[model samples]
Target chain A: MQKEENKIQAVIQINDLKKSFGTNEVLRNFNLQLNEGENIVVLGKSGSGKSVLIKCIIGLIKPDSGSIKVFGEEVTDLSHDNLDKMRVKVGFLFQSNALYDSMTVRENLEFPLRRHWVQKGKENVNDLIIEALKNVGLAETIDMMPSELSGGMRKRIALARTLILKPKIILYDEPTSGLDPITGKEISRLMLDIQKKYNTSSIIISHDMNCVKITANRIILLIDGTCYASGTYDELKKSSDSKIKQFFD
Target chain B: MKSTILKDFLSETGDLTRFTMSFFREAFRPRYEFSEFLKQCYVIGNKTLPLVGITGFIMGLVITIQSHPSLKAFGAESWLPSVVSVSLVREIIPVITALICAGKIGSSIGAELGSMKVTEQIDAMEVSGTNPFKYLVVTRVFAATLILPILVVLSDAISLYGAYLGINLKQVVSFDLFTNQIFEKLTFSDVLPSIIKSYFFGFCIGIIGCFKGFYTINGTQGVGRSANSAVVTATFVVFIIDLMAAQIADIFQIT
Candidate 1:
């Protein structure tokens, strides 16, 4: 809808993106634009290539042909070092909540900072870790291994790790998957709080209708490797289109 | 079926070679993982030493006891220490130690990395702007390469001590005389080639284990397959490398 508004800047732009695995096409002519400070939930069923779309944005999967420009720099054209530098601003939360089993929660949070050789401003690494943990309300879990945490707790810890870098853009791959409804709601609310606190733009890949309703400023439905329809949740709920109605049902 | 099998074999070999070349490329570059390398060395070396020691002791004892009768029958019993020292130093102990490491360390690295790959930790590390290959693969391979040689040397010493114990069980050869007999027959040629070959064994074990684990797909079941194949492939490669080392040593007239 904002496509007509030339005033707002698009943080991420995808134009005619295409990707395929051998003969099976995963993405075809998929186009999207993520505006600054907006939360766009990419709604799709399993194997609908929602995950693949975000991966292409982050350069994890190379698209067969397309243009992905994040902050006006072409992603596929960037060299390895430049890609790594670009990733520092782009946070990706895996569906599995990929916490390192060998590390304590504090160590997991510290990994990115140390890896990027990030210099802190008047605050040491410990303080940053504490701040990140406090933001997730898991300050007590600093010393605990990932195995010691529950599924919900692990997801929160992983979110905390992502927050440590204070990324401008956070990509959530099924952020509320594999949890009870209550925990899932709690996580969805926490995601809103993070967006407000950090003012981060996000692309959330999820099928949970409740999650989509809670987090999406706009929703894009992915069908047949393309954007089938997109609108506000209530707007899509009122539509009579069978493909879009199936999702609501 | 035959063509498919051959194609699969060739594909696997091609992948492994590329993996090895990538390792070498990253290994010489800067941002080396020194702390991780030291930690891997500790895990691969200190933890596995006891197993290598016990095996070496048993091997030395059994070989000495088995060969004593043959020597005594030919009136060459006095050459027990000399003969056992040469054989143990030149071939047996090195091969056995590498095989043990291939089973223990190879399977361990394979399973550990395979699980990490399955759980998406490696992918997570990549998104965090950290090179997982440098942090995980290169450090482990280098640790295995450096540690195996030290282990082989220690096993050689322990095996000689066991040979002394085996000799003292039947005859009254003094400790000083046994030591002298071993040293007199043990030349640089005998000690050097075996040690060199152990390095190759360590390199192959480390690379093969990492290769299997890094490319693991199909979830937990794939992880199990990787660990099993890591042991089997590493064990086979150890023998092949040993055979090649023996031939090279023979051609050079080192023995």
Candidate 2:
């Protein structure tokens, strides 16, 4: 009964996930839990398997042995169509923005809706596009191509595309990477606002201490293919452990 | 080292065969991407007409000029229309057009898809509940297979016109007489085999290009490698198909 209650509260639960590529073991016995309406930041150094963990969560990479349950359903056991259905409720923002270069901002926003056959009137789609752009503060660049946009503007457009689906959970891969300090802070604040407005859960993978400090409700330190430590930013910063102190220092 | 190369080749062949089967499976499933398919047809078919037409015209004119001297030596120059027509319709136009498309269309598809893969756009499509394979591969393959035959037909007509112009360049022969000579020698056997082989060529180009691009790795440099390999592999496959097609046509006495 208690386990059932925990499952009901958690939006995503991963246990003992293991993955390797050709003798290089990237993830081993990793575990994490994301509760509803919470922001969990995963902090790790370069090549520390943070990206692998995110990919496994999104079903982009198959784990060697483990269980990843999203909303009480096992992701590893789902078929292709079922996985696609699950992804409709979950949005992923790539580290490189991953905006379709061939498409304009409006078309990029319309893609997920068309793919999932989300039934909306033409006017409704227009309204949604406008509203999503408005949220990201780039409502004027609707017809512009991704190549035409600056790095920060491209990131905003990508976020708008993710928001058009109105997903219940969002996964951000290095949301503030490759940006100036001011832009990174602005994106971090925008992320916080979106979280409060939608009441959506999120898992952000990043090594940016400023992003982690600004956006993380809780931080998980991933080391040696597993969760080494997890705590609030302040709590982790106060720790005396050398590994955790290295990050805070 | 030789054995290792052979093993890798076999493995790649197996992977490609499995990819082909998966394409067929997804192609028949629900929610067909008809709009994207039509868009691809427009891009691959309609856009290629100018290049194919000019190449065909030049090929026909050159063949007539080159073959005329030999026929004149034997005093069989009057048979120029018949010989050039048969060769153009039966073999030259189809093979040349396929090779050209293998370089143009195949490389373009490879580079576009390879860049998409590198940038994680394909993964984005998948996560957004879009069938990237259907939207990307199936449409392109279907378009190529269906459009190449049409392109070949257009080329054949234009080349015959060029042949008429070429014959007129030497001595006066009415367009009516020249066309009549070609039609008299032309049979369904010659045309059908050639048209049939073009479909295989199109399929080979589409599939090879998709395979290379879809499985690309190592980032931007890999995109260049994919584009290069796609053209090279598709060109080689075109020749292999043409050779097999010739043997089959001969055994059936279609040529």
TM-score (all chains, Cα) for each model: 0.98, 0.98
Residue B158 accuracy (lDDT) in model 2: 94
lDDT of 1 at B25: 98
Query: Clash pairs of candidate 2?
Result: none
Q: Give the TM-score of candidate 2.
A: 0.98
Per-residue lDDT of model 2, residues B104-199, tens digit only:
889988999999999999999988899899989999999888888889999999998988888889999998899899989998999999999999
Instruction: Considering only chain B, report the TM-score of model 1.
Output: 0.99
**Residue B247 displacement in candidate 1 (angstroms):** 0.7
TM-score of chain B of each: 0.99, 0.98
| Best DockQ among the predictions, by candidate number | 2
